[model samples]
Target: MRDVAVISFSQLLVDKAEANDAELVMPVVREALGRAGLQKQDIGFTCSGSSDFLTGMPFSFVGALDAVGPWPPIEESHVEMDGAWALYEAWVRLQHGDIDTALVYAFGRSTLGPIEDILALQLDPYYEAPMWPDATSLAALQARALLDSGRLSDSDKKKATAEPPKIVDGAAAVVLASGDRARKLCSRPAFISGIDHRIESHLLGVRDLSHSVSTEIAAKHAGCFEKSPTFAELHAPYSAQELILCDALKLDKQVTINPSGGAQNNNAVMVAGLIRIGEAATRVSNREADCALAHASSGPCLQQNLICMLEARA
Candidate 1:
């Protein structure tokens, strides 16, 4: 694989975005490109992540393309998932050896509707969706199972209860480049040394709620266990999920988790996971740490997880 690196990252998080998605994406996209010393034309590929369900508009991601200036026309794509997954696609595109750089972004406003209610629709229609259990309640079930398993002490449970995830409306963008192009874009690049994503069985009843086998498998594939990370930006919307992820990744107390305050401080539905990756990349770019792990999850109770291992070029 050709070396790919996150050259620049930018994000905006607020209680509510007063403008439309296109308006919201423009600033972050511009800022990210500027930070990397690149113009829109300099980007070889562009990909975005957003959900039509959030806006209740079909092809909502299409409108956001205006912010990227498709004037001269650019090779681009979109994912119905988070921006982190878009970055994953961009990384793969760079490996084709035809593209030297790519732009990735995500924008959404969960405040437009009942975020939890919308999330419930993703559950199994026959078994789980009919019950209409919101995200927190489903996560609570996972927490109860974890507690019952005797995996967490009473103190851990209390700690988990204290830090509930904060929901916000926002957008984020990242610039990626291959090898020499990456070094030219930024003095310090957060090279994507390893990246892998995995998903568990969709049925909640069949999976082990107490352990995140999918996360473990992804982490192993991403070389997360090969070298210690100085920090980790985990997209755990709930403290219980954070606890679960920490245990799955086997992070030690010495590793500072969520220095950017994680999703607990500010989370924007489709944008939060990408922000986790951007946050970790920013740290690596700033030389705050040599190695870091950024995680993004989708589906209720962390059914899908992606592990990104980033490191400074040696």
Candidate 2:
């Protein structure tokens, strides 16, 4: 492996932030680059995760590129997926010897519409579209399935915690580097130890929503906890899904789950995943834990999942 690492990260809240999307992204990008001890010109490439649906227009991300100053031109791509996948793309690019540093980011504003209704677009528009079901209903279905399995009590299947998610609208950015460049940027870089994303079938009705088989599959491939993860941050939009994920990761009662609150507290679609990874990295950076598991999800009822293990070195 190329030993890529996250050197710096930044975030802005979703609903509470007053700035427009482009305005929100610029400072975040600047903060990330500033922490990396480099300027925009130093970045090897840039990748972002965002959905056009959220903005009600195509190429919405193209406007975001302006936040970074495109006069000079830079390598970049945008995914219809979440920022978590965008980070994955940058990680993959680092596999080659030529690239040393890159930037990844995501942004979402749920207040623009009934997010559940908007998310319906991710479905196949064929058989699934006819139902016109929103994410909440599908997650409820998953909640019911878990209850039926007798795996958890009704209370355990509730929303994450009393603490509200940081629901304000926001954006987040991170800079990554490999080899010597990584060492030069930070004294303790949160290395991209293992990263993987998996997607379940689009038809919510066909799959077993009760469990995160995708997470389990991702964990195995993602080389979980080099040591036991003392902390874990999972994207569970509902209370029930939190219980399901804990079971899927076999997280045991010992791990600190979502001290950063999680999606239930506040969520912006594109950046939420980046926030999860950032939370995990922060724990490692602060010397609170040697390793941590950060998970991000997309699609209805956790149809897609990404597991990233971040490790800190002495």
Candidate 3:
């Protein structure tokens, strides 16, 4: 496999609750294109991640495409998943050698519904769905398990929840390239050094609530989770899950966590996981982070997770 680098990134503020989806995403998309020294048409491909259930309307991504402009139908695709998954597809397409670089992004207004109940749809239909365990309640079950295990203190968990959960509405985008193409585009390219993702059983009660199997598997697939010098940006929807994942990955004090304040600080539904990846890439592009780990979660209690390692090369 070849290396791909995220060359640029842009994000809309979390506070823009009034703007519709198109208005929220346009600025971030243009800003990312501008930073990458390209125009919309110059992009070889485009992909996005978002969920229709959040807005009670399907094809939310189609409206998002209106931001790119008329006709000729640019090569693009959309995922009913997190933006990180869209990024994953973009990376895979780049591997085929036909595409040099691609743009990936996502937007959402999480406040549209009672987050807990809304997320229950991701659970199993037969058994778990009937119980109607909400997102927070499922997360709380994980938190309670962690506290019971003595892996984390209630005080330590407070670090992530010190502020109100960022029940936000916004969008994030990133541009990526390979080798020389990346070098020519930016003084420093935040190489997508490594990435991997996996899924666990969907039943929240069936899985070990205190651990993330997906995280463990993804770290191994990425090939440096055990011995690497990098800060980690994790999409821990709740503070306790962050602690549990840290233990599963065995990340130590050497690894700085979530300088971006993470999703617990501000949640944007389906796209929040992908935004974590963008935040890490932005740090590398700006030269503030030499190497970093970006993590994302899906399903209740992090039943699915993705890990990407990024580095800046001049």
Per-residue lDDT over 27-98 for candidate 1, one digit per residue giving the tens place of the 0 to 100 score: 999999999999999999999999999998999999999999898888999999999999999999999998
Q: For candidate 3, write residues 1-314 as lDDT tens digits.
A: 87788988888756547877888888988999999998887778889988888777978888878877735777899988889989998998888877788999898888777767878888878877788877777777777776666656657756433223567887889898877888999887878877899999876667888788889999889864654646788999788788877877888888888988888878887778888888888787777878888898888888889998888765
When superposed on Cα atoms, how far off is each prediction in RMSD?
1.1, 2.1, 2.0
Number of the top TM-score candidate: 1
Q: Weakest 10 consecutive residues, lDDT, candidate 2?
A: 157-166
Candidate 1 residue spans exceeding 4 A from truth? 162-164
Candidate 3 has which clashing residue pairs, if any? Answer: 166-265, 166-266
Find the candidate with the highest lDDT and give its number. 1
Candidate 2 lands at a TM-score of 0.94
Report lDDT per candidate: 0.91, 0.83, 0.81
Candidate 1 shows a clash count of 0
RMSD of 3: 2.0
C-alpha displacement of 77 in model 2, angstroms? Answer: 1.3
Of 1 and 2, the candidate ahead on TM-score is 1
What TM-score, computed on C-alpha atoms, does each candidate reach? Answer: 0.98, 0.94, 0.94
